[model samples]
Target: MQLVVGRIGRAHGIRGDVFVEVRTDEPELRLGPGAVLLTDPAATGPLTVESGKVHSGKLLIRFAGIKDRTAAEALRNTMLIAEVDPDERPEDEDEYYDHQLIGLDVVLTDGTPVGELTEVVHLPYQDLLTVKRPDGSEALVPFVSELVPEIDLENQRCVIDPPPGLIDLAEAELDGGPEQDR
Candidate 1:
């Protein structure tokens, strides 16, 4: 399986170093020195990492043969991908890879069907699960333990305990309360 590890950002300096918007949980393993990553455009790489460091809390990476700012800048927005075993699991039992959760059925605590887990949105603060509802609409559920109490991978399902309007915002709007009367 190929997983996205990071996206190339602007050139960091006159050197071939580029800032990276990291996407992987294991940056040390996937984006470290000597790691050969495949590129999204299919033409830009198999780029090998020459060196990497954290600067001002951002990841900066230098690639072999990309010798100048212009060359590094050309890689802007390019996605870096790493090859991984499909069956590989995260070291943390509580953590899950995006691929592992993508296809699971999403249901409420009482077993009410909500949707299918479609995508995992990784944000700076928290991850979100994109759910495709039966009616073809989509809902973003915060991937927090309090709301998402259980991930039954064995059954291919995720159990959520959503507050009102979290999953049914449109319906909630339709059933307006005191504010609607005003």
Candidate 2:
């Protein structure tokens, strides 16, 4: 199984080093030096990690033979994929891959059906679970443990304990209190 490890961002410097958005929870293991990763477009073939460092909380990576800013910039938005074992599991029991939760049904804490897990959005600060509602709408639920306290993978379900306005922003806005203005 191939998993996306990182996505190339803008060029960092003139020396071919480019910033990357780390996708995998195990960046140190997946984005380490000497790791060979396949590309999405395949136009650049495989890429070998020559060096990597964190700058201002962002990860910067340099690929072997990429010697200029133009070369690095050209690879922007490219996804770096790595092969994983079929039976691989995260070292931390609480940690889960996006694939594991993608197809699960999302319900409220009281078991009210909300949506189906469509995708996992990995942001710099936090992760979000994109859900497809029955009404053909979409919702991005932050994957915080407090709001999402349960992940019953055995039953293929996720329980969401949404805060006020988290799920039904329109309803919350419509039922505005005295503190809210028109």
Candidate 3:
């Protein structure tokens, strides 16, 4: 499995240095000299990191053979990936990667399937689970333990106990209107 670690933002300066938005919590553990970065599937090979450093909470990196600003600029928006084994040790009980949550079935307490997990947005206050309904509508549910009471990864299902008016709020937002009592 290839996990995305960072995204090349832009060339920083005249040199080959490029600013990268770190996507992983373990940036320090992943970014290092001699580390290999795969931009995409069509690339000839992984780009070897000649040098790297953390700057202003982002990764500043220079790749081998990329020695100019033009060369660095060409890599903007490229995703840096690291090959990870799927059989690796498990994360802590409460922690889960966004990839693991996406595609999971989202249901009400009574097993009524409301939607499917499409994405997870990490915000400062809380993570938001983006659920795509069968009708092509979408709902952003706050991943609070109170609302999302249960998550069964193996079975690919989640039980949600939405607060009063939250489902209406989500529906209103999806419909681009204010919530009105039915």
Candidate 4:
């Protein structure tokens, strides 16, 4: 499936222009006319970009057939997706799409299955992988080499070597304890 790159916000002006909240680092690659966007799976209504430009650090796009403010307003909160092939190479081996990591089985260095990756949280410092354990608990492991030693995307597994006290930190956080205690 094609990964989401942006979402259409409310109409910016009466010229069919709409504000786009960019969700990808490759914003420049996604801009321009004739670009196709899929709003949803069931809604096969592909929106063709009539014109687009980066404005105020966000993408300002106008879609074909959307001429008025009302027409643009109707597209608010619509996710923008393009058909992406899996064979497309990534920018780097360490870099991966959040979708690619989701649902992968998380394991310890010894190969003990801990849980499955439920979500990836992008923070200022680092990305955190939230693993949903079999016991219905959640563990937030930082996506660092020290913590997440290996990722076998093909096998759908990840090996982690969490730093000392990291597990206890996750446990304390799950138990509603203070951050300092963790």
Q: Best candidate per TM-score, number?
A: 1
The C-alpha TM-scores of every prediction are 0.85, 0.72, 0.75, 0.79
Off by over 4 Å in 2: 9-19, 54-77, 168-182
Clashes in each model (backbone N, CA, C under 3 Å)? 0, 0, 0, 0
Instruction: Write one digit per residue (lDDT tens) for candidate 1, span 1-182.
Output: 89999999999889899999998999999999999999999799999999999999999999999999999999999999999987898999999999999999999999999999999998889999999999999999999999999999999999999876788876667778445887
lDDT of 3 at 130: 91
lDDT per residue (tens digit) for residues 2-47 in model 4: 8788888878878789999887766666645887878864363589
Assess each prediction's global lDDT (C-alpha) against the native.
Answer: 0.94, 0.89, 0.80, 0.81
**Can you give the lDDT of residue 125 in candidate 1?**
95
lDDT for residue 70 in candidate 2, whole number 0-100? 95
> Candidate 1 — which pairs collide?
none
Model 3 RMSD vs true structure: 4.4
lDDT score for candidate 1 against the true structure: 0.94
Please report the candidate that would top lDDT against the real structure: 1
Pick the winner on lDDT between candidates 2 and 3.
Answer: 2
Supply the global lDDT for candidate 3: 0.80
Winner of 1 and 4 under TM-score = 1
